[model samples]
Target: MPGLLQNKVAIVTGGGSGIGRATCHRFLQEGARVVVADRNPAGAEETRELMEGNDDNSAVSVVDVSRSNQVQQMVNDTVSRFGRLDILVNGAAILIRTPPLAEVEDVDWDLTMDTNLKGLFYCCKYAIPAMLANGSGSIVNIASMSGVRGVAYGVPYAVSKAGVIHLSKVASAQYASQGIRVNCIAPGGVDTPQMRGSTASAGTFEERNLEHPMGRVGQPEEIANLITWLSSDQASYVSGSTYVIDGGAWAIAT
Candidate 1:
């Protein structure tokens, strides 16, 4: 039998590493033509290289999602290369550690919002038209537990994620009638480079692992599993919902 996304074409931003890299691999495993897009050329190429015998099924596009022109070109290029755009995984983001909300510098705030929130908006803006022409599409936006609840450390990061969640909702409302599905996933403590780096130290990272109700943080593959499901026709009826994948950590916190 063919894979779930056998005939689909997808563009996954931030496909250079972490959850984005995992999602790109998962999408390809499910038999989709994937464009591994990221600002880091080396990372994107590395991801594509890791795919066994999938050279023709995958390509890499270097993009800074924060820039509208680059984002537009990325969409145009994908459609040009693949013939149509069927799926979009907006996984490009950055998390900067800040002192506190009051002490958060303007530069940090702008950078975080630009890449995390504005970048997502730009992806949706450009990809929507392509999806509309295809008659249907699935979009999965990556958010974080920081957005859903209060957190002490990165205020800009948390706020940007919250924007992503709400933006997904608004986009779903506007486009679902057009046969496009938009959804968001807010993961708590996933074991990704971003998470580890944001933790700032090995001790904090271990603390995160031990604090999770499951005795470990979620893995990138685990998050990618849900992303693949949401991107496929199996979730044709699902849209505008934020699914939190946090390994039961949120439950314990509540």
Candidate 2:
């Protein structure tokens, strides 16, 4: 049987490590040509190396999603190289500081919003037109459980993710007739370098794990699987929705 995304062209932002990297792998395995875009040149190169054996099916672009010019160029480059754009995964984000709301600085909030929310806007602003020309495409944004709940100290992260969720919904509705599907995946406590590097004062790994009813943290691959499905034709009927892959964490109250 042919792969789910055979012949498709995909661009995954922050596609160098953690969930982004895993999603890039999954997209490629499904037979889609992928562009791994990241701010970190080294991480992007690492992802490129990881997909080297796949030949010309993949490429990498160093991009800071927060910059509109860079985002526009990245989209243009993908289309120029691949000839078309079918899928876009906005997975680039940052969690610089997790101070309580009272202590949160303006700079921290601005950085988080610019990267996590505005970045998606920048990508979609440029990418949607390409998808419109193609007459069909899918866009998946990586949201967070914090967006759905009251994350104690992660105010900026939560706010940015919430904006993503709303943006996905609006974009999905606006372009549904144009054959573009937009959705978001809100994951909880996935085992990512960013998560691991969070303030230790927040809690221990075990404590964090127990926060979920599943009694464990999620893996990046698990989230990647959901993204692949969402991007595939199999999810043609799905749009403007947020899938929570939080292991029932949000379903239960602590």
Candidate 3:
């Protein structure tokens, strides 16, 4: 049998590494043509190389999702090359560990929101029309557990993720009738470079694992499983929902 996303065309932002990179691979395994997009040219190219076959079915786009023009162009180019757009995974984000909210610098706050929140907006803004033209589309925006709960580390990052959750809801309401589905996922302590950097040390990263109910953090591929499922026809009835992929960490959190 063909894969779930066979023949579908997708754009995965932040496809350079972490959850985004894993998602790109998963989408391809499911037989979707993927555009690996990221601001880091080297990282995006590397992801494309690592993908199986890496033939005409896959391409890379160096994009800063924060820029509307670049995002628009990325969508236009994808449509021009692939003839249509069917799925989008907005996985670009930044996490800057900061002092408590009051001690947070103005620049840090601005940068977080611009990339985390506004960047998602631009991707959705441009990708939606492309999907609409095809009569259906699925979008999975990667938010964080930090958004749904309190995190002492980065206030701006948390706030921006919360915005992502709400934006998914608003966009779903606006477009569900038009065959576009929008959803958000808030992942708990996943084992990614961003997580390790935020933990600030290997010891701290391990401690985070012990703190989790599963005694281990989620792997990038683990997160990608849920993402691809949501992007598939299996999730046709699902929209405007925030699926939390935390491994019982939130359940036991005090």
Question: Per-prediction RMSD in angstroms?
Answer: 0.7, 1.6, 0.8
User: Where in model 3 is the C-alpha error above 4 Å?
Assistant: none
Q: What TM-score would every model get versus the actual structure?
A: 0.99, 0.96, 0.99
Tens-place lDDT per residue, model 3, 1-254, is 79989999999999999999999999999999999999999999999999997799999999999999999999999999999999999999999988998899999999999999999999999999999998999999999999999988888999999999999999999999999999999999899888998899999999999988899999999999999999999999999999999898887775
Candidate 2 clashes: the total is 0
User: Which structure is stronger by lDDT: 1 or 2?
Assistant: 1
lDDT of 2 by residue, 1-254 (tens): 78899999999998989999999998888899999999999998788788745579999989999999999999999999999999999999997756788888899999999999999999999999999999999999998888877778689999999999999999998998899999999999888888888746446877888888888999999999999999999999999999999898877865
lDDT for 160 in candidate 3 is: 95
Q: How many backbone clashes does candidate 1 have?
A: 0
TM-score of 1: 0.99
All models: lDDT?
Answer: 0.94, 0.91, 0.95
**lDDT of candidate 2?**
0.91
Residue pairs of candidate 3 with colliding backbone atoms = none
- Output the lDDT of residue 213, model 3: 88
lDDT of 1: 0.94
